[model samples]
Target: MRIVRSARAHIARYGEAPSFRELAAAVGLSSIATVSYHLRRLRELGVIVETRGRVSARCPHCGLTP
Candidate 1:
């Protein structure tokens, strides 16, 4: 959940998604692969979605891309 939260915050603050390295650093993760794994799981859980090669968290209430 931290990664998703971080990603949403980063998008809000910067108007763009964070890269894997940036997301890892933001979440105190040292491995990009670990971030990748979590993101993959989030995608499967429908907590996040990938569009046009970009990943973003979905609005929990409406399930819309944020």
Candidate 2:
């Protein structure tokens, strides 16, 4: 949930998706791998979509950008 919230806020603030490092920092996570894990979960949950090396939020959902 923290990952999701951070991702959403990051997108809202920057108008773009964040990198793994950025998201990790925002969420107080130490591992990019951990962030990646949450990201995969988000994808499975249909919260975010990754395309062409960039990440974007699904409509009506909070998400992080690449």
Candidate 3:
């Protein structure tokens, strides 16, 4: 949840978002796969959309929440 919130923050800061590794580092996760795990949860909860490659999301126009 903190990771996703941070990702949202990075996006807001730069009009872009972090890659999995970057998010992991930012949130103190271990690796990209771990990042993927939290990301999957976020996606499942409708907090964010996951796409292939870096910083890909749909409708950041919409609220990120379950």
Clashes of each: 0, 3, 0
Clashing residue pairs in candidate 1 are none
TM-scores, in order shown? 0.82, 0.74, 0.73
In terms of lDDT, which candidate is stronger, 1 or 2?
A: 1
* lDDT score for candidate 2 against the true structure: 0.72
Score candidate 1 by TM-score against the native: 0.82
- After best superposition, candidate 1 residue 52: deviation in angstroms? 4.9
Task: Work out candidate 3's RMSD over C-alphas.
Answer: 3.8
By how many angstroms RMSD does model 1 differ from the true structure? 2.0
In candidate 3, which residue ranges exceed 4 Å CA deviation?
Answer: 55-66
C-alpha local distance difference test of each model: 0.81, 0.72, 0.70
- Give the Å error, residue 53, model 1: 4.7
List clashing residue pairs in candidate 2.
Answer: 17-65, 17-66, 18-65
> Mind giving the per-residue lDDT tens digits that candidate 2 earns over 3-61?
66776677788887778788888888899888878788878988877665545656454
Q: How many angstroms is residue 10 displaced in model 2 relative to the true structure, after the best TM-score fit?
A: 1.2
Tens-place lDDT per residue, model 3, 1-66, is: 578677777787767777888888888888788888777776777667765666434435566422
Q: Model 1 residue 6 lDDT?
A: 90
